[model samples]
Target: MRADPNLYDYWPYRDRPKIVWPGGKKLAFWIAPNIEFYEFDPPKNPSRPGWPKPSPDVVGYSQRDWGNRVGHWRLMELMDRFGLRGSISLSTALIDHHPEIIEACVARDWEFFSHGIYNTRYSYGMDEAQERAIIEDSIRSIQTATGQRIRGYLAPALTHTERTFDLLAEYDFWYTCDLFQDDQPQPLKTKGGRLVSMPYSLEVNDVITYGALAMDPWRYADVLKRHFDQLLEEGERSGTVMCIPLHAYLVSQPHRIRAFEDALAHIAGHAADVWFATAAEIAQVYREQYWDQTVADIEARGLASGGTGFGPAED
Candidate 1:
């Protein structure tokens, strides 16, 4: 196990170079809808079991099946009403499993980035050949399906190996949502190409709010509004990024769907200083405008080395 993954430096939030997003917006607000496919019975990794219960895991798999069958359309239509396009964190195999969903997002011109082959197929204990194979497969699949070369990565079920970031760099991925270290994009000390860690807010994520925190519809709506309010205020000093990562199965349920709408209305209708952006768009601007200066600041401050995880990563 590594004592330090050494992914990035200690970048302070208080004062550094300023960022001005497109249209001079104070905050970059993007939504990541995790459009994923889960297998009812998937191959197991040596390090972790694929399913929580016994084989088949019918109840668990069916709920996610609901996400594709019913929840996804509900969620997409709602976003459409807001003129919002999804920056999808995709389980790439969904293209074959559910081509209709992929086609719909493509029609909307939503961004598609890799989230591995399937939510159930984790990357733990894989060798270099195996890991690179999956990355190659994802690139080929997404390009073939959507005519969009994937530029970002979020590991399957958040599972990763020691070489994950390095491999992402080698593949020329622009950003990764796997890191929760900051609210703004920061440079990753990769073994290869330039990559940034785009903020994919776990705190306000629907999966966290609904599944982990057990928040009701109204509370989740309130939370989103409040979260945005603070970030927008802070963004005045320098740009901030706000992402509400979502799972359709959790947030697009009949009872919960309106809460999702309410949150978007508050941000889209009530705010003027927000840049409604795709994750890739945000990554491009950051790399062009802020990358050099941010790297210099880290070096000047002597803050260019830190550990990524306390223990070896399981996901």
Candidate 2:
């Protein structure tokens, strides 16, 4: 199948504009605590199923609900103890269903951004108008609840249509976590507006680590340490972004919390080497200082041609 032309450019990582994070640090670090609300019996999308099994999946729903009720508080307390502020990937409907969670996060001055109306909702199979409505709903819901304009988006259940990026730019969203194209922030080629893709982890995510990879807590911790260590080394040459995407139900589980805490502590120990910042902070800085320069540099390198060529064959 031919690749869609509207997505983004083909700038490689080997040599690109070097990003210097604030505080003269090598790596910019952020934590994303996905505060979600999974519905008990949500509508199914034609393109994808909501529940793994069937509707009225009480076990699945309640288990995820556990995150909001008990697990999130534990995770928040731990983050507070470590002096780490959260950049929340929120399900906007929670403002109505679980205002207490929103209040708690807001009280900490955490950055709030949309993950869509609810975790159970999917963006797949949505027409352009439907998708635009969803984006509007998220913007209005979040603005009403938190009194802040959302600048970032991580599509609900990581689902999206061809038009998602362009629409986000049209609606004034500054960054997206959906594109996992690089370790550093990169410009997205939207139709006629500005948008950048921030680095959001799938590899080091608690859900992927424990659920998909089936790794234990300690193994997950080891993975975090190793990932941080290598990125820290490479970042000295050029700044890199490291994100730990978390789900409270997974990482805040009693058996898993200590190991995850240990990993955060290890990373924080090198405070002088990394810029621990919110996603908004990173995006704002890049937009102001480095975005135009980065676009110019990519264009200069002849990387924006968007051809299918993979360069010359290996010697």
Candidate 3:
């Protein structure tokens, strides 16, 4: 069977039901700091290249390594300054190599979720057994080290197979950051159980803005402010979610960190209007209050028959 191209129902954004966040807040704002670890000479997958240049690329390896060694701390300090907590999209092996960084995040009461064992590792071309083992490794390693059961996943480098969602549900994951289709949480069509697609921004992400768009810090800051402004305004009528995806290597440089901080300050200033939340927290509340209604609305619109789940709910 072919996959559904539109992951969710065809609900027009303007006409959808208003989502009222707790405390009548307009926006659900969260930060995801991608605390990653990249191996210098990773095993290759048929679907994707491990590095842009070649194996043992010193410049590429060291640049990403700097995020772990130096840049992450600088980014964490600024998060502290704004009293913001991160939901870390972590590489599982980082717990072994840089336990101190994980320890610091734990101390700040931040949430940790799997981004696979290594940033260089891709989910492409994996069989069901291999994928399941990776999920189990992540769950076990994180629980053993940090004493928290991870409930979210962002596929490494955003690579995934059809079974990815099914496996995540079986392992009891609550949310996924892989889908960029909506500005609000939506029920996902997984096989074993329920999953929520959290609003994770690709456009506002540091890697895209800095690397692909060639945006300088000043322009980056402006774009962030503008993104927030539009969302805040639209959110007054219905609740919206905004995520700022950051990589320590890209945003934590001395030249760029201050501008990023300034943008954070601007968003933080509107504390009364937004609820600063983790992805799990947002998913939990939506599951409790809105999931059934959303499902029902999709059904009413005649758009709920396209999923590939294992049971009768799927077509």
Q: List the residue pairs that clash in candidate 3.
A: none
Error of 3 at 203 (Å): 0.3
Candidate order (TM-score): 3, 1, 2
- Specify the poorest-scoring 10-residue window by lDDT in model 1: 306-315
Could you give candidate 1's per-residue lDDT for residues 1-315 as a string of tens digits?
766677887788999788888998999999999999988888877777888897698888889999999999999999999999999999999999899999999999999999999988889888999999999999999999999999999999899888898899899999999999898899987766879999998899988889889999999999999999998999889999999999999999999998879889999974579999999999999999999989999878987554343323322
Candidate lDDT values, in order: 0.90, 0.88, 0.90
Number of backbone collisions per candidate = 1, 0, 0
Clashes of 2: 0
Candidate number that wins on lDDT, 2 or 3: 3
- Please report how far candidate 1 places residue 162 from its true position, in Å: 1.2
Q: Report the alpha-carbon TM-score of model 1 versus the true structure.
A: 0.95
User: Sorted on lDDT, highest at the top, how do the candidates line up?
Assistant: 1, 3, 2
